[model samples]
Each structure stands twice: as structure tokens, then as C-alpha cells.
Target: MKTSDTTDDLRQKLTHELARKRALLIDRHPNARNSLRIMLTALGVTDVHHAGRSVEVLRQVKAHHFDMILADYQLEDGRDSQQLLEELRQNHLVALSTVFIIITSERAYHNVVSIAELAPDDYLIKPFTADELHGRLIRALYKKHFFAQLYEQLDNGAFTEALSTCERLLGQESAFLFDALRLKGGILNALGRYAEATRVYQKVLEQRVVPWARMGLAMALRGQHQLAEAEDVGQSIVTEFPEFTAAYDFLAEVQQDLGKPVEAQEVLQRAAAISPNNSTRQRLVGDVAARNNDLATAEKAYGNVLRRRRGSSLKNLDDYSNLTRVMLDRGHAESARQVTDELRREWRGNRQGELAALIMDSLCAAKEGDAVKARHAVEKAILLHEALKAEGATTRVSQKMTVDLAQACLATGNEATAQEIVRQVAAENHEDRAMIAQVQRIYSKAGKAEKGQELLAQVGREIVELNNRGVLAARSGDLQGSVQLLVEAAERVPNLQFLVNATKAIFTLLELKGWDATLAKRGLRYLALAQTKDMRNPKVISARETYQRVARKYGVPIVPLGPSRSPESGPG
Candidate 1:
């Protein structure tokens, strides 16, 4: 019995030695071979298989799975070793963050460590001993465990909780300070606390300029309607970090908002060059090109976006809707219909899809001179609006839909209904200048140009009468009456130059009578609003100048203002 046991032990020892020799042959690196061999010898690890090449070895590693991966700093084709590890984790091709240790030479340290998120759990220097590698792996596991809660919160989109944890962690001044701050900024942005988010970003930047910090600041500025400032910041980021994609997005948005369509397209082109797979970027380029009347480029960009990817975040139905419109505009009705059919198949009766199809129906019917079909579609839209209204859905923006329906109604010779619809939209959105302009366009498009002009002229005359009343009231020293009339007139005829002038006059007279900081500030607010709508309108400029004078006279610091050109001469 003793002799038989001895024979079995000898056979096992031989098998183990052969396996070790095979493992050594598979590992090309001297350190990997030596360190792994040492571990195998210590553990007497049996059943080891040898891989013929790097691909084979990686496949075996994937199949067998290691508790920790000691990857070379420079992998096949100059790919970052850490990134390969992350790709494995991300794709579930490997277990999560399985103690990835980047094995690097001293010369490659900087190159290996330059990337974020893909930073290894540890770095195993050349000539590392088995003991050193093992120690680093254990340390990484402990550190990861310590922050597991934070990792989970961040990954699960519990940004508010994550931000709170980050704040607490920041008090400890941990090595993850910047990461915490960055995560906080992202959370604040997600929550729409753009101003606070911007402050946090700037705070980090003031310490040391970082690409993300700069990008975050630009985003905040964009949120605040400070597009010009955002554009400048975006340009600076691009100049410094030409490869950064987010900077290009910021630049495109700023330029678009500032009415520079061509510049927006240029930024989008640069972005596409960097990341062509992004359907959103391609669609944006196409939209901007379309806006600039560059049909050929627009068509190419849209076609690329539609053709390239099947299932992506960039494959929004809105993109297809917009593309279809462009196609129709380019006299490709059949092509537009093809896209519409594809969308119908994809969406499979979604409400938004139905709405888009209806809008397209209206457009097609209008083009084909089928006024009856157009009116039917418009009525369907109105019915949808009625349903939404019954539901008390506050989020429903029905004005645009109403305007569209009104236009269709007018086109079909339902003048009475069209007039009533326009009146309803005007009354509901009397405060919004952009909405008013859209209303005017809808009227003009439906062959009601004279009617639209008459409506605005009547509104203008009403505003003028109110302005005169306010002016007379102020001159007669009835300050309260003057303020009341002017405020009412301003509301009634917003963006009308003379009414704004009347409001300014009354506010200044009130301030002159007594110290009403609130009144003065209210006057400045009206003045600012007026300036934004038409900076070159005489009333806006005069009010702004008056506010500046009042601010100085009362020792109130003049608030920083926007462009306010002197208004052109108009009737007194």
C-alpha cells in the first residue's frame, strides 16, 4: 500500500512540473513568467494549460478567469492596457474590476497613467516580486471595498446620494477628492442646479485647470443664456484640448444660440471627425447645414446618420422626423415617405409617432392641394389637444399645435374657425414674443397676411393709447396711477417700443418722488426684458439709459447689461 501511494505522489509531482513549464512558455514576459511560476510552485497549482499565442493566452485567461490580472502597460497595437481591462469589465467579458494591475516599465509610467476611469487598481513595476504583486492586489481589493457604496450610488444614478457621500468623503481629503467633486458637478447638472454646478466647476478650475471643469463651466453658462461667454470658453477649451469631444458640443450649442449657423456646422464637423459614430453630432451638423441653406452637405450628414447605426441613443425618432422634412423640402417626397414608413414600423403606434405622422399628413395634404384631408388632420390634432386639456396635463405645450391647426383651417377656407384659434393663442400666450412671432408666421403662411398685419397694427395702436394715458397721468403728478397704467400697458403691448418707454417714464417719476428701491428695480427689470426682445428699439434703449441714470443717482450699482443700440427714429 505504501509503495502504491508513493507512485501516485510521484506522478502528481511530474504533472505539476510539466504544467509550470507550460505556463512559463505561454507567458512572454520574464517577470510574469517568474512571478506566476513562483505562485504555482508555492500552491502546487495543477491542471494548468498552455496557450500557443497572445490571443490564445487571453482566451484562456478569459475562460479560466484569474482573481487578478497583471496586464502589460503597452498591449497589442499600442492600446492602453488599462483600457483593455476596462473594456473587459464593461462588456462583462471579465469580472468587475478584478484587481487589474498594470505591469509597466519605468519609461512608460506617464503614458500608462494618463487616462482616467481606466486607472488600474495598482501598478506592478518591472522586476516586481511575487510578494509585491500579491500585496498590491490585496490593497486594491480593500480600497475598492471601502468605496463600494459610493461606486454603487454613482453607477445606479443615485446622484443626489452620491453627491452627499462625496461631500462627506471630501472632508477626509481622500485621493478621490477630484473624483468626488466631479461626480458632484455631474449630479448638480443632472438636477438642473446649473448655477451651483457652474460655481463648483469654477472652484475646481481655479485650483488647477482641468478639461472637465472647463466643460462643466461652459455648460452652466449655456444654461444661464450667457451663450456668448459660453462660446468663448468653448473655444478656449478646443484650443487647449483639441481632441476633447464635449468642448465641440458646447461650441456648437453656443454658436447656434447666438445665431451663427455656419460656425455651429464647423464645430459639429470637427466633432464628427473625432467620433463619427455619434448620431446626435451628425444630425446636429445636418440641421445646422440645413439652416445655413447648404442642402447638399445637410443631405449627406443626415443620410450618414440614418444609414450608419440601427440601435443607438442617436437614432431618435426626432432625427428621422427632421430628416424627412428636409427631404420634402429638397423635393424628394418619395424619399420622405420612405423614412416615414420606416418610422411607423419602428415606433409601432407610439403617441409621439402618431403626432409626427399626423403633422407629416398635414404637410403632404397641403402640398397636394387636398384641403379636405389637411383640415381633417388639423381637426385630429385639435381633438388630441382637447384630450390633453381634459387630463390636466400641465406639461402639454399646445400653442404650436394650435397655430398649425389654425393655418390648416385657414388654408381650407374655414376663416371663422382660423380667426378664433388665432385669437385663443394670442390671449393665452400674450406674454411670449417668440410665440407671437410664430403666430404671425402661421397667419402669413395661410394667406392671411393682411389680416395678420391688421391684428398687429391694432394691438400697436392700443399700446400707443395706453402709453399716452400713462404719460399724461405721470405729468399730472398722479404717480401711482401712472405706475399702474404703465404696468398694464407694458403687459398688454410687450415688445412695443412706446409702451416700454412709458413704463420707464413712470418708474423714474415714482423713484424721483420717494425712495422705492423695489419700484426702481422693477423698472430696471422691465427695461432689461424690453432690451432683450429688441435691443435696437428706441423704447428699449431709452429705458435702459434711464435705468442706468436712476441706478447711479440712487447709489445702486448699475447691473451689467446687454447690447442696447439706439433705437431708429419713430413717431413721437
Candidate 2:
């Protein structure tokens, strides 16, 4: 086992270089951090930080630029390092230059989500020595450096430069040629150049079958609305690599789009079986399950969401709210009341939470045949709604909470309140034919279909007038006036197509006239409200793009429309 002096010298040099590398070690266990510290120290790494929680880890990454992040897959939080990486990437919190190497104890982690698809730098199993770990890190660093220009452009959201860089580097003989091609495919897909992306992915596939490349091909096809072909590709990927969670998720989305929600549910259920603890996955499972009228499955999925929320600060309150909603639907009054009680306890001082719990109580009371209590609950809810409005809560968010309030109002014989609530919903969603229909059905179920139609007509007329005036304002070179009129009109009826179009027109006017910071902000605010109504609305999507373009042109942060919520006004 004799080694040459030259080999020893090279090892010493590599070790010295690694010592200067800034590293961050993240694990929930103190012992794990200590162990990793020792291992990394052996590699001559002197600068390192340890974080036992994601919040702290994120704080670290956000505060300092780390060269390497060695994260344990299983963090104390409900999410793993993969989820952490996702948050970091999606929010642009970290540069792609930072090498992320995830460490997991179980091989099963590999089957849950595709590391290649998500593009984490590397994956390692437990019981690895410093040298093996170092070897992996070296390759990852090499890859990161080799694709520096592409990553630089990508991190800056410079798709054109990224594509050009990938193209230039792709035809040359390089160790990272396949990686370059993958990056090119990703850039093309991001730009919605689907046919070119398909060719790039196919080229990678011809070189060798890769999970990420196959998934990219499926995604490009889906982008082109080639649902059947995308499904085939997605199904094959999942069949061949059952661990590819993205494929399953994509396939399920395609199925839902194709009106095969039941199939989507099955696909997600399988993914859940493999990665049971992912809250987002569980939430999606609940949504599809509920959509398909599989209440039992839906309840179980939301219950899973609730359980996962217990220890995690990143709680989605909708899980508790939806749990109560469906429990009432299933005629489980006691269960619904208990869930509402838990929600109240969990969010004791929250105004919105208090209102939601009150709404749920009314539902439970009605289900339990307590008319007086239900009516009183509705009255209390009305007061809470007024109180929130007094505290500056926008009334334009026509979501499930408001729908539940309307439903509670009707259940409690508060017909006037019910009419006003449904009317507001109709006003906001004047252009959403489906939602308008749902609102009509809401009244029909309560024996007020004709009245509902009249209210919708009244509100629709008001929205149309406002929209028409706003269009005239924009056309007259009154960009600010147009923005004000359109945003106010949109807010009056949060999800109206007319108002959405008006916002888009205002955005265009602003674009032509150059950015007015306040007006552009207002435009985003209006689009965000519209998104809460129907994110898939074409008008909303177009306005969102326009808003981003203005934001980018103005050198401001492109405000992302807040989270897209589950439809609150959908047919029960």
C-alpha cells in the first residue's frame, strides 16, 4: 500500500484548497452536525456553519453567500432538504453557484423525487467517508464551474443569454456537454420554445436515457398542449422510474386538464405512498380527491395535511378550514365542530381565523339542527366580517371563506346578508362564466335562482360601465386615471373578466407611457386580486405578464401574484 510522494503532494494541495472553501452543514441532529464537522475538518475545511433547522438554515443562506451546503435530507421540519432547495430556488434566495449536496440515510428517498429533475448538485447516502464525500463534492463543483456562464445567466433570469451560452458550449467537446444540452433544454422550455426543447431533450435521450431529460420532454409536450403524448411520456417515466415524483405530478395535472380527475387522484395517491409527508403533495391530493367527490379520501388527505402542520411553522390554514368544510358536508357535525374548535385554539388572536372558525361553527350548528345557534353564529360572522373590513381587509377576495360566509348566511335565514355576499361574488367574477353559474346554483339550491340572476345582472352592468370608462380613460392618455378606475373597478368585483381586461389595457397604457411606480404597483395589486378569483383566467394571466414586464422595465422586484387558492365558490 505504498503511495508516491507526488500523489501525497496532490492530496495535500486538494486538502488545502478545500480548507478555504466556505461550507454550511445543515442537520436537525446536533450529533450529526458534530460528526459532519469532524468529517469536513478532515478534508481541511475550516470555514463552516451548522444549522439544525430550515428557518435558521435559510437565514444563513440569505445572510451569507455559501460556497457549499451539506444538508441532511431529513430535517426537523416536516420538509426535507429537497423542499428547502425548492424554496431557495423558487424564491431566488441562493445562487446556483452554491453547491448543494443532500445527504440521506435511506435509499427510499431516491424514489420519492428526482434529484436530477430538480437539479440539486448531488445526492449521497449515509455512512460515507470524508474522501467519498469529497469526491462527490469535487465533481459537483466541477460541474458548477463548468456551467458557470449558463448558471450566471439563468440566475439573472437572462434566458436569451443562457440559451446562447448553452448553444455555444454544446457543440464543443467537453466533459459537461450533456449537462450543457440539459441546460439548453431547460432554457428553451422556460422561454416556451417547446419544439426546440423537445429536440434538445430528445438529443440527450439519444445520448443516454436520463430521468431529467425524459421529464423535460414530457413537460415540453405538455406545454405544447400535447396532453396525450405528454401523458404517454410521463406514464413511461413513472413506470420506468417510479421514484420520479415530478413525472407523477405532471401526469396528474395533465389528467386533470383532460377531465380525468379520478386518474389524477390515483397518480398522486401513488406518489403520496412514496413521499407521504410532503404537505404540498398531500394538499394537492386532498384537492383532487375532493374534486372527484371522494370525501373519504379527501378527508384523509387533509387530515394528513393537518397532522403535518402540527409541528411545522409553515402551516397552510386551508387544511384545517377545508377539513371542517368537508366534515360538515359528510354530516359529521361533531367532527366539524371539533376541527373548528382546534382551529380557533390554533389561531386564537387571528382575525381571519376567528371569522373562519365562526363560519364553520355556523355550518356545524345548521348540520346539528340548531337553528337559533346557527343564526347567532351567522350574526357573529357578519360582525367579524365588518370588523375585518374596518381593519382594512379587502372585500374583493371571492374565495371559499366568503362563499362559506354566504352559505352560512343562507343556512341561518339571513337572506339579505346572503344576497349581498353572493352579489359581491358575482360582481367580482362577472366574467367567470363557471363561477357565475356556481353562484346561480348557490341561490338555486336555496330556492332563489331568479333573484340570483337579477343580482348578477345588476352587478355585471356596473362592472361593464366601470370597465368601459376605464378603457376610455386609458385611450385618452390618462394612464393614471385608467389605472385608478380599472383597479378600483376590479376591487369592487375582484374577479371580473371585464376588469381584468381593463387592468391589462391599463398596463399596456402604462408600458407605452413609461412606468408610474404607484400605478404599476396598483396594477399588480389588482392582478393579484383577480388571481384569487381565477388564476387560470386568460385575462388575468396576460395582465400578470404585463405587470411583470413593467416591473422588470422599472427595475423593481417582479411581484409574484400571491398563492393561488383553491376555488371557494366552486359547486359544493
Candidate 3:
């Protein structure tokens, strides 16, 4: 394929394909964008768009999909190309099929590999000719075309089919064997076949010391609950490749799970220092620091999170509440009030924003000793919370915000309301140790640590009893009764465990008693809810596979597992 004649033939074909595709050029300077647009046009890419800022690029991506995106290394908003690429992929704004090329100067090119946590398909050095760009575009387009079927399956959430495609490619495509193995490892990990995924990654590592393969091996180890071994590999990666910021994040997660909060905070802080503009890592630093009772670090991290995302589309109500919570904790009541005011101004008509603002206002007023104002704000917040719950929008509210509301209720002498709110939250998130710790901290602040313990124990018991009843019924061969109990539990609590259980149970019943459209729909809804919580959970994947198998057997349509989104929200 690398022979001159074959390469020429492929380039000719790609040139024809380029004429029918759309492209986007992103550069801070107008002249640079124009020059790139001309080069693309010369290469037969006439349907070209240009953006001068990262925000503009985001807007264009949300409004329309492009076949190719070429962004300069440095963006106008202080974000580098790597950060933009990461954000787009993480939020599912861009498809894997899109060809992304970073255009970097010689000086920046040397550091690109070290700094990039999310690698682009290819990169072009500055001051290159149209022929050079054409050469790179043709190669990237060819690879993209080769994996088109696999990407389609992935985008559709058909993991099983995607895995099969990877296996086929691995056996046949000598040029793309490594690439197929990489995709196969990721798919296996996502489907929760950690043992097999571990083998795939290990096989790759045996051939060469690829960073991605090592990271995949670490993740596969983590999935198998081998936290100690995973931590060792993660530490080695960061030590050997200090510029790999993602290793810092992975190491921190492993440390946190291993009951090393101080270590976790330190690792995250290191990552944040290396990549200061990553709002997600900054938020994680804030969370871990707060849990460690390092209020000063927490305050700075949360402030950075808010500042980085201030005007971006990724900004949300939780950002405001996160900063305000730390500010109030640090006794910066006035500063907290200022942030709340900003939140109100930024989110004027959004109901969730109003709820967040009122809750923050109540906390600030309480901190300032204005009991009357605090009580008034709490009353308003309670009403809004009830309205949202009645409208079935409670899931839209973040767990952190719910904790803040409970804290506000406790501050304003509405102990009963606070207890009930915490009870419901505790019931739903009993498995999340961090969230439970947060709930306990709220109770401890209100001088009811003992009561919090009692309430959490009671919630735990109730959940276990509810789950056990369903399991026992299923064991006794009463599948119908088991489904009924599990469905009721899921509707009542809707936690990941219950939702997965209910979905699995319903599909089992359907397989036995013939498919009932109503029952199948209910099961699919539960599966979707579980995916929202954790898309890669082994149980969720198993449930999804079960539904697919049963649907195929009955010749019914199988719904894709991708999340539904509006046009404004970007690609599904």
C-alpha cells in the first residue's frame, strides 16, 4: 500500500471523495484560516467552513457535522487543540468517524505528543504545501473508511457487533492489525469482559510498549478489581511519561478507591497543574480536596472550574453551586453571595438554575446571621424542589445540589424536611461511598451525626430487604413475582442496582412468556435509565445484550442504546 503507484491511486480516489465532503478550519488568525481554506479548496474540498475561536468551532459542530476538522494548536480562548478534542469526544459532540488533524508549528510539534491526552488522527506541520496536506488527508481518509463499519456499530451502541467486526479485521487486515486490536480491547473492556480485554492488551504490550496499550491494560486490571496492580502500572506510566496527564487522573481514581484520599488529592492536583484548563479534572480536584477537608485547595480548584467554563456551552448550574459551596464553607459569605448573583444572571429563566440560586442564597443568608432571609430563601427553594419532583425532573438535579438543599434545610431549622431529603438521597445512592460520606458530613454539621448514622443504616437495610425479596422469589421459580417486585423497587428508588435488576428480570420474563410490547418497553426504559448512570457497567451491558437477543428472536425492533439528544445538544 505504501508503494508509489498504489499511493497515487488511493490519493486520486480520496481527491474525488473530498469534493463531496465538508471540512472545518479553525485558527485564531483570519489569515491562517483563509490560507487553510484555500489549500483545502485546492485539494477539492470546496464545502469548507471556518471558525476563529473554540466556541465558534463548538457552535459549528453542534449545528452541522463535518467530514474533516483542522484546528490550530493554539486557540484564542487559552485552550489548546488537545483540550478541544477531548471535550468534543467526552461530550459525544463529535463522531469517531470524523477526521481531526491538528496543525502545529515546529516548536509546538515537539511537545504535542507529551501534552495530548486525546490524540488526533493526524497532524500537519505549519508552512506545508497543498500537496503535503493532500497526502495526509488521503491517508487519514483511507483509515477512516477502513473502520467505517466498526465506528457505525459503536455509534449505534451495538457493542457485540462491533466486537465481531474488530475480530474480523484483526484476522484479515495486516496493515490495520494493531488498530483493530486497540479497538477490540476497548470494546471488550466496555462490555465488561475484563479478562479477555486484559489478554488483548497484554498481547499488544508484548509486541511494543505503547502508551495506550499500557493504559488499556491498567483499565482492564482495574475492572477486574486488581487495584494494587493497576496502581503500580499507573504509577510507572506517570513516572516514565510525566507529560501523560491522563495517567495522573487514572492513578488518582485508583488511589481514591484504595482508601488513600490524600494521595488522590495530590495526584489530581499534579494533573491540574499540568493541564490547568481542563475543567473536568479541576472539578475532580475540588471534589477530592473537599472530601479531604482541605478547604483552601478545594476553594481554589472550584474557583478554577467556574472560571474555566464561565462562558462555554459546557457550563451548568452545578458549577455555580460547587464554587459557592466551598466559598461558604470557607466563611466567604459575601463571595458566595456574589457567585449566586452571577448564577442568577447567567441562568435567568432556567428553573433548575433558580433552584440552585435560592439554595445558595439560603446558605449565604444563614452564614451571615440573617435568619429571616435564610428562612425565606429556604421556603422558596423547597417549593421549587417539590415542583421539579412532581414534574419528574428530580433526576435532572445533581446529587451535590440535593446535598446542598438538605444542608440549607438543616441550617434554617427545618430538620424534618432535611432528614426526609437526605433519606431519599441515601436510599438511591447507598452504594456510592463518597456520596454517603457527604450526606453524613451534612448531618455531622447539623449536630446530628448519630441520627445520620441511624438513618443510613435504616436505608441500607430497606434496600437490601427489597432486593433480597426479589432474588428469593426468582430462586423459587416465581419469575413473574420477581419481576413485579423488582419493577416496583426500580420505580420507587431507581438506583443503578435496582434498575439493572429490574431490566434483567423483565427481559427474562419476556423470553419465557413470549414478548409483551408493554413489558419490553418498560424493561428498555429501565435499561436506558441504568445506562445514564453508568453506561459501561457490566450489568447494564449484560441486560442490553439480553434485550437484543430476545428482540431478535421475536423479530421485533431493537432500539439502539445511544442517548437521545436534541439538535442543539450535538450528535447522539
Top candidate when judged by TM-score against the true structure:
3
State which candidate, 2 or 3, has the greater lDDT: 3
Per-residue error for 131 in candidate 2, Å, reads 3.2
User: What are the Cα lDDT values of the candidates?
Assistant: 0.61, 0.74, 0.86
Pairs with steric clashes in candidate 2: 19-44, 111-243, 400-568, 428-493, 428-494, 428-495
lDDT of 2 by residue, 405-497 (tens): 888887778889888887776776565544565566557657788887888888878877877888898789787687677667666655556
Output the better candidate (1/2) by lDDT: 2
Q: How well is each residue in 1-572 modelled by candidate 3, as lDDT tens digits?
A: 33344645866777788999999998999999999888888888999999988789889999988899999999876788888888787666787788999999988897887767777889999889999998898889888877888887776667788899888778773577888888888888778889998999899989998777888889889999999999999998888877888888989989999999999999999988888988889999998998998999998998888888888877978889988988888899999999999999999998999999999999999999999999999999999999999999988999889989999999999999998999889988898877998998888888989998999999999999999999899999999999999999999888999999999999999999998999999999999999888766677877887888889889998897673221111110
Candidate 1 deviation (Cα RMSD): 18.1
lDDT of 2: 0.74
lDDT of 1 by residue, 322-367 (tens): 6765676677777777886787777675655565566666655766
Model 3, runs deviating above 4 Å: 1-11, 563-572
lDDT, candidate 1, at 91: 35
